[model samples]
Target: MKKYLHTGILIVILLLSGFLLWRHSVQTRVSHEVVRVADVGAIAWVPFQVGLEKGFFADEGLSISIVSVQTGDESLKALLSNSVDISLAGIIPYSFVALDHPEIQVLALNTFAKDNQIIARKDSGVSRPEDLIGKKIGYSKTTASDIGVEFFLKNHGITKGQVTLIPMKPFAMPVALATGEIDAYSSWEPNIINGKKLLDTRAILFNDVLSTYTWHGSLMANKTYIESHHSSVLAFLRAWKKSAQFTKDNPTEAIAIASAYTKIPAEALKQIWSRYDFVANPSPEEVVSILRTDLLWANLHRANPLATIPDPVTLLANINESKI
Candidate 1:
């Protein structure tokens, strides 16, 4: 009887150990998990690019395919259309979409702040914000540049009406300013960087100097996808966090990755690289601040006055910060 009892106990223990091992294996086997990431091709997204080059995504049991869009809004549009799993774009643009699509979930705030400057040609004789009055100023409508210009003008008591606002493509702004088509242009990097190199221009004002949203690049996902692919989401964030850390620790390699990916010259990327703050996860308060600022910006620029402002709680409801 004693021998039979001991044999049964040993069998039970072995069975339990075998079950635990199987569970571990199954949890790690996140195969065929593909993440379609649509993002702007900028130095701010270097961490993700570095992750792809270093196999960080695969290490987390995910396969990621990146689609580089011309602008952040385009990337967000792709997300809204269900053409991509994740969208990496500016907070203000995200806010515009989120007001209508409350189903959007934010994963992480990847970058904070940029040097959106008002670049004026030296010969234009526009030395300060006040000089912009009655002069044609070029900017991409409703973008960071527009927001930056608005706040800068507000600081100097110059309204948009005071300036002959020329709506121009960002790439066209530098040339327009140089060739006397427009006296000045409000643009962000690498265009601004390129403009400086191609023309004798001076930056009169940067976004940081103004009372604007500043700008943050965030990673977002559709709510349905987040709900169903919880593990996958966590895995992606883990990989992203790793990449961000790697970038900080290895600036030279990070610069190279960003230059190659963005097609911005290495020197240009380096000059403005420090302007970007790459954070893998944002605090709840930070997320709320960004959302609130976006709402205010949209009210001013997007003509979305009737849009409901999202509170901090509602904004952070879907943010998964467990790993960070």
Candidate 2:
């Protein structure tokens, strides 16, 4: 009789263990089975991080998993390779896509004309686009910065032959310019701010140089992923919009959050943050303008401007003002 009771107890224990394992499996599946996202480590993605930290994505019944990429170009590669579900890089890749593919649709434009200026050495005798010729021009990746420099120089009548373009990262731009390793590197802040102290020249209106330029650091998803999870895409966007509103409402706290992501000091970020005003659905005209320039610039740079550019109207989202 005692042996019979022992066997019965062992069977009950096994059944209970099975029940607990089932519950744990269900919870784990529910926790992360939504959307997978990726972001380049830049200030452009501050709002997305803020939303995740504040439970904004969770509130939308969505789960966004992010992986850090070294640069926007790498992020695009990840999205294309299916390594990441989505990309938070700018529309620069869209330009190459437009010429051929634009598989990644630009869902929303978060910011534009954010202190993306070109500075010069105090005594470099370089003040305008005209002054850039015969000088070594520094640009990184032949990516977004190269596009900016191309337009800035062309509008000033400086051709490719007039200047030398060297590839350098954004942070490295300040040192390259200050050390005079290159005559003028297309500088973007916080490098621009640092460049001001290192190099000695005043900026010559790099912002809106192509007034039609739309440097949108937008949300993008692959066609396959979006097809399978349409609701997930909408939910992520809803969460992102809420974070944008939070940024507008709490400008100070927003800076602290952005400061954490960028690793620039909070005090320094406060000064930089004031220059940019982030938003969603930056007009269609803005998208067209930037695409036109990026494509033409890429053509000149020997990069393949094919396999991604799709129709702008189909890609951009027109959110209702009243809906938000």
lDDT of each: 0.75, 0.67
Off by over 4 Å in 2: 1-30, 123-130, 194-214, 283-309, 316-324
Off by over 4 Å in 1: 1-32, 200-213, 317-320
Can you write out model 2's per-residue Cα lDDT over 14-121, one digit (the tens) per residue? 999999999997776567556777776566677887897788888877777778765566777788788888787766654554455455666666765354456666
Cα RMSDs of all predictions?
4.9, 7.4
Which lDDT tens digits does candidate 1 get at residues 91-143? 76777777777788677777875666777765767766677788898876656
Best by lDDT: 1
- How much does candidate 1 score in TM-score? 0.82
Error of 1 at 15 (Å): 19
Error of 1 at 36 (Å): 1.5
